[model samples]
Target: MDPWQAGLARELIMRLPAGADSAAAGSVLQPEQLDGWSDLDLHVDLPRSAEPVDLLAGLEIWSVTEEASADRQVLRAVITDGRRVDLVITGGGRVRLPDRAPDNHIRALVAQAAAKLGRGDRLIGLHLTLELVRHCLVQAMLLRDRDQGTTIHRSGSARDALADEIAGLDLDDLGVTPRPNVVERTVDLYARWRSELEPDYRPDWSGLRAVIDRGLAGR
Candidate 1:
């Protein structure tokens, strides 16, 4: 955890109205604490009568409109405290409130990779690297299908692009490579994602592609 980033997150949390509940923060880097170079993730439990947008009007964060989920109105603003904060406003009933939360499956995988890297476990690290990339690619594919209003299916171009991106990473220098069964493993995961969250709403693939491309480009 960066001390400066942690302080900035705390400052923004304190600025919220007194009644907000289930407000908490997390980071993509550590996944262990609300600390990282990437933007801070903040969730605020909203009251039924509250207007989420209006409440966030004064924040200086960029609005990540494309990434907003149906159940939450999300806004990203760069706070005066010198950190970008992602504020997710959701109804109280939809919020998950917990203390000492366990690492999500994805984060757990990332943490395991980091641990392996620390101990010079090259093979294990490579496996976890593929796991992480596969997870993200599957999520992107699912999101694409949901936006397209179609049954879950694979997009060869999109998957190939993702594979290219993964291959281009400096993982070899870090002592990792794609495992022998990487593709099959990815296929299995994709099938599971399709079964679990079949698209319920029509998605605009063209628009979704633009968003996905921008995200991949780190825009």
Candidate 2:
């Protein structure tokens, strides 16, 4: 029997609206064995009439706070008990990975980095920088035809396993010393991978690239 806690999952499921359906995902779903650190990974599917924001509002009983909301496809949050909840909500359709999910995910981060940088917030910039690097690593793995779902669902060990296979990249411990350059380096790294993986793939990184370069010059 898995020792991991399912109380959170059960409670979350109970709170979901009548039309909503959910199942185990992430580490919790990979193996039946569970532990103290095993949180919940609930993939929720809502009927066409249901909305993620509405569902989130209902979660107020648990003092849930939204971490990020992107349409009805993704909803992440933290509960009052300090456990993180990642809900990938779909509109009655199954959640499927796109062929170029890495490409799409990276571009979104670049845009976010630009917005946060404009606000002159080092803290948010640092966070985005870290996320960018991580996504790039994952993207590279996807390009090589590895199991994208499992790799992302098991991020900690997945990163380690991929890192061992890819040589000479120094992905470990990209400290936030030169904050501006961190973003630049991450984008540059992604571009290199993108070029190798999909030669025809193109994204408008000029604007963000300019900003990152300008920041590096002043530093």
Candidate 3:
């Protein structure tokens, strides 16, 4: 990690409420350790009484990683208190944990990716690429759920209705106007590997790539 980036992450971690555990920071990618990308990932255990939104007030957000399935919401805040920091808050289910719950597909994927990452294999590059794609796809699904006013716990008819509403929304408004074929290709890849990897690993890449493409293109 870059010295400046590590300093920033440490500074942000220090600023969090006392008693915050698991206060560690890492680069977004393994190769980033060589290229110096400097994207920081921080995990903190927040108190139940703590309001993340209130803590994030006035902080300029670089991005928000939303995982409805895990009820994990993270705010990548930049230019806050003169430092850039990524604040990840887990909503009850503790998305950062490496265990699988019945309804938490997003967490399962992340945990699997992290496990692969820890293996230090020669195919780390390929694992990293797949993990990046999976992360983007899951984030897209969570954003879709949020836009449709559905929570991770919602299911049955309510979940189906929300999914339809999300599918019906104008892709352009979400900043995703890319070709459907490309989205489908990524989704198909995700589907093929999802079952082989984890039982809860269901990533709708078609919907996800659209959102990711929009976010990147918009940037």
Q: Which candidate is the best by TM-score?
A: 2
Candidate order (TM-score): 2, 3, 1
Residue-pair clashes per prediction, in order, are 10, 1, 0
The models' CA-based lDDT, in order, is 0.46, 0.52, 0.41
lDDT of 3 by residue, 125-191 (tens): 2454455455545545554465566655454433344344334433222111243422233334445
Question: What TM-score number comes out for model 2?
Answer: 0.35
Per-residue error for 181 in candidate 3, Å, reads: 21
After superposition, the stretches of candidate 2 with alpha carbons farther than 4 Å from their true spots are 1-105, 114-120, 146-180, 212-219
Tens-digit lDDT string for candidate 1 (128-202): 767766675666566556657675555543444545555655555542123222322333344345445554522
Model 3 clash count equals 0
TM-scores of all candidate predictions against the true structure: 0.32, 0.35, 0.32
Sequence-dependent TM-score of model 1? 0.32
On the 0 to 100 scale, the lDDT of residue 135 in model 2 is 70
